[model samples]
Target: MAYWLMKSEPYEYSWSQLVADGRNVWTGVRNYQAANNLRAMQVGDRAFFYHSNEGREIVGVMEIAKTAYPDPTDETARFVAVEVTPLMAAVTPVTLAAVKADPRLVDFSLVRQSRLSVAPVRDGEWAMLCEMAGISA
Candidate 1:
């Protein structure tokens, strides 16, 4: 399955919130690139739940429960969103500082496109990150 990373500000929607809600509609993306990434996602795909802005760390795993669809919250109707369900929390959070310090992830999209809210994760990078986060790859 494809892998991806989805970021949410902890104050707005933390990992705890996702866990509490059980499922979430991932919407409100304004960036064309991030929007496209959401559109590319499919049901069953795994994603890293990242707490951006504040913690800047990946704290959990999630599964895409629904494929891309028009975001109802978007009046312009140009963007898309997916439904996600919490999978499991990372045994250990993978901090942004740690990612930056890892030579293997130097070329990772998270490093290259720090502004992206939704980004694709390569196979090798996903495996390494899962390892770092203490999750099964």
Candidate 2:
């Protein structure tokens, strides 16, 4: 299965919110690149639930529950969204500071393309991150 990372602002939608909701449509992506990433996602692919902006950490794991579909929020009908289900919350949220400090994660998209809200995660990096979050890879 492919691995991915998706960011959401804590104030807007926190990890706790996702857990409470059980499942949700991951929409509102305006960026072209982020939209492309969303389109590329498939059902059952694992993803890191990142708390962006103030929180700035990977707070949980999620799985894509639905493939790309036309976004209802888009009046132009140009974008798409996927549905995601919560898998697990991290024992210790992996902060951006922690990621930047680790040499093993230096080349990660989270570092190289910090502005990206949706990005691909390599298998090795995914394994290491799972370890950091106190979960089995």
Which candidate gets the maximum TM-score versus the true structure? 1
- Candidate 2 residue-wise lDDT, 34-121, digit = tens: 9999998888999999999987999999999999999999999999999999999999899999999999999999999999999999
TM-score for each of the candidates:
0.98, 0.98
- Give the per-residue lDDT of model 1 (tens digit) for 1-137: 99999999999889999999999999899899999999999899999999999999999999999999999999999999899999999999999999999999999989999999999999999999999999998
- Model 2: CA > 4 A from native: none
Cα RMSD to native, each candidate? 0.6, 0.7
Model-by-model lDDT, in order? 0.96, 0.94
Q: Candidate 2, TM-score vs. the true structure?
A: 0.98
Candidate 2 weakest lDDT stretch, 10 residues: 128-137
Who wins the lDDT comparison?
A: 1
| Model 1 vs. true fold: TM | 0.98
